[model samples]
Target chain A: MMAKSQTHSDGDLGDLLRVRDGFVLADVDTRSTPGYGQTKSDAQDDLAAGAEEFDELQERLYAQSRENPDSPAVLLVLQAMDTAGKGGIVRHVIGATDPQGIHLKAFKKPTPEELEHDFLWRIEREVPRAGYIGVFDRSHYEDVLIGRVRSLATPDEIERRYDAINDFERRITDAGVHLVKVMLHISKDEQRERLAERLERPDKHWKFNPGDIDERQLWDDYMGAYQVVLDRTSTPHAPWHVVPADRKWYARLAVQALLLDVLERIDPQWPVASFDVEAEKERLAAS
Target chain B: MMAKSQTHSDGDLGDLLRVRDGFVLADVDTRSTPGYGQTKSDAQDDLAAGAEEFDELQERLYAQSRENPDSPAVLLVLQAMDTAGKGGIVRHVIGATDPQGIHLKAFKKPTPEELEHDFLWRIEREVPRAGYIGVFDRSHYEDVLIGRVRSLATPDEIERRYDAINDFERRITDAGVHLVKVMLHISKDEQRERLAERLERPDKHWKFNPGDIDERQLWDDYMGAYQVVLDRTSTPHAPWHVVPADRKWYARLAVQALLLDVLERIDPQWPVASFDVEAEKERLAAS
Candidate 1:
């Protein structure tokens, strides 16, 4: 069930920002508003409105899952440059819903046991169970992104992963997972400013990693790798959306709209009672 | 570091609601707000105010955990009869914080694999890693409560569980986990209204179960089992609090206050940066 409704005046932000055929990473302006004509205040207002809608839709999805064991689950895969507001999207966008309904996993550097297995092995274990909004902070895409840039994996192995990820996405989405893969696109100039800001604040230091600068030095190489990712894995069932990261508020608002699109399409209805309500009420009264 | 500042004009709700010495299960009036002197509007205003404070305190705890591997974690254990608003507490209270900082687990009937091991095995697996606020909707206390009331386990098995729970709690708290054990105390009359209301609404049907009626039939026995649990399992490390839950607002507010107290005591400070700040600034600018 593809979501057909559009609540925003600019139409579906997902469609406007999606990486399609002949997409180029460098060509897209990081600071552009793209489809949104709204001001920062408008974005904030829309985000708050979207959050309320998300909370209700999430509740419906969760309630539907209680009876239907095969009820569909949504997997939101967030891949971004450092300080592109992945954490903010989590807090400001999806954070308004019932915490019980959301399953959040931040994939860090693989543990020894995780490193021993196929990349998808660790990832598949954490897919949202039925009726959940599963979020992967830095997902399997890392195995390819960082893996490709750092030459951590053999070229042959890296080549196999692109297809493996495509195959994996196809399988899970076929098995009732609505995948919303996002790449938060920020420019090198924006990266320098963000990193500098992190360094400026003592409270923010714990979040600033020296390695992020090390990665920033290879900006061109990482951009090419991301382009390759966008080209190879942006498929029908699991297409990737390129959210401009320079505007933190816009990125979060866009992601929230994308999720709302999916849930609205699924249209999870409240489950009918499986028991005799009249008899139960009588028994409940007696008790 | 114990949080000495309380926003509530009424002294610490944690102390007022705590199941302390000479406490009697029958003595607490489920409808009464023991120390809170306010109208429902006042409770609502206070609850809205508490959510903002909880948000900031939770952020500090999460931030501390990032820099210090041995940072403290908080565990909230909720127990009570069905319809006592465990889900409500999860939604309205903890829902106000960053979902990344909260780890929520709702214990169900034991799976074959889980039943294969000790009761605490499944529990231990789900404990919040450092720098998190972990919540257990129903926990190992079930082994003793349901195990005793339904004779699911022998007297010998049930008898062993209480001591086992206390020992397990003592060990975890020593390992930098702050335990907040709460029982949402609701009267039978209040429960009947809640169940009837669920029966009255089609959207809420999925939550209503005939099994709840079966459990309701054994209310006194379950209360007896609870008394035994409070008597045996409540310890210095993991004391229990009975929040009169006839008023849903008070229960959620009280649980939030109890958590604030623990966080206040732990007082997770913003982590100190490990790197040379000025050097990093130069390095970041060059990149």
Candidate 2:
């Protein structure tokens, strides 16, 4: 699996980590940081350095959008099992910049208002503005994730959701919103240890829930649901990156690097000011 | 001014930088990095290190909100003249984190759709979701800034907007959006130099505008407009921080520090998971 990931360049971490056709989610190591050949501390330092540049590129995207409304925005959808560190990614990766440029939504149990509409209704409302970054902690995939695992939705409905999500993402990308879907993968043992730690810590008690055990009973079923999700919904326009998330620092760094790669590809520039500079300078000097 | 800023503890940069009653925007030097007695390089390093911690706290805020919808969001409204580096601040200060948690709006010329409604209709649509950071690049304040300088709105209407803005912000704060308004102030000489630099580079020519000079001719008028804006709308819920914009690094660091201070005060904690952890752990281990 590592060898397969190594075929891609280090710079294209997205390609290296992205799930392609006939990919096996189970084969990928949850502890591996493919394409990045650095120590944990070194990766941390790189992430810190890259953050400044990321800020610049994100700003350029924002500036271009201001000058041209058709400019593109980026959306990162994080899907993971409870305790897989989706929250950590949201904080460590996306939290580095000014809160002003981000749009974050953590999908919870559908409300009465939400159930009245299609599952995608709430998601459509939260897409990032042009040049902004939109993050979904858990997303429409939930309808398929827990829905399939818990049999909350019928098979036909789950299938329809997969199609709906693909179409919805395509429409978004066509309208200049780049989508990066990430699945944070952790092993059963790692999760057990994390859960035990949560139980041991008084401060972490709020973060633990007994319901998670009910979900754990269906781990294989949940994995099957995830496999189906990765297979059906990971389209070319909105490919899914299955990040090995046992190591939180590496996961955060990889996600950051992935976003940086996307922003660099977009290459948004500072929009040319549409006003007269020479005349303005002279007039200002005179004033 | 620097001495006054230094009188406060380092953690209280927000209060140090905030505009209060009888505050004079012009009296604040545009070159000083108040409440932060570090070199530009040191500040940059400090900002880099703090970026991770900032991301964590912001995530906690978002997490808390997810667990409790009534949790507050922070809104950073940036107002500045062209070439004052609002773009830089948005990128450097706000851009460092996950774009997922940010809601950024750069208000430009109102569209036919926008013109049909109240000036704030568009603004209301863009307010940050709960637990998110909302950033306005040239926000509703522009209604008064340009509206006053260009006389786009009648003087009576301008006065009415001042009142309207106050009411609107009061409502926003009342609804749990902690607003941190900032004005990036630059001098006439600095503006000339930046404009000239913009003209000298083809890559930057796109960022140069002739209309900015027309506005430059009314720099004093704009200053008076900003002063009035600060005086009328800088309420307790949403105070204005007039940051010195001559040094881009210093301004970015100061604004970031100011936001950090606000987030610290809000101090959002990670939400406790609302499930049975022990049962879940046992079920998982057995499985």
Q: Count of backbone clashes for each model?
A: 2, 40
- The list of candidate 1 runs beyond 4 A from truth reads A1-8, B1-8
DockQ of each: 0.83, 0.36
What is the per-residue lDDT of model 1 for residues A74-150, given as tens digits with 9 covering 90 to 100?
99999988888899989888888998889999999999999999989999999988999999999999989999999
Please tell me what DockQ candidate 1 reaches: 0.83
Assess the local accuracy of residue B120 in candidate 2 as a C-alpha lDDT between 0 and 100: 91
lDDT by residue for model 1 (B1-287), tens: 01222544457777787776778899889988866777788788788887888898899898898888899999999999999999999999999989889999999999999889988999999888899999999999999988899998889989988888988999999999999999999999999999999999999998898899899999999999999888887788899999999999878778888988898889888888877888888988887
Error of 2 at A35 (Å): 5.0
TM-score of each: 0.97, 0.80
Candidates' C-alpha lDDT = 0.88, 0.81
Give the per-residue lDDT digits (tens) of candidate 2, residues A1-287. 12222332264677788899999988989988778777788767776776777666766787787778899999999998889998878766776665556777888999999999998999999998897888899998999999988888788988899999999999999999999889999987788888788877755766666777678777888899999999998898989999998988788877887888788779898877665556655655675
iRMSD (Å), candidate 1: 0.9
Whole-model alpha-carbon lDDT for candidate 2 = 0.81
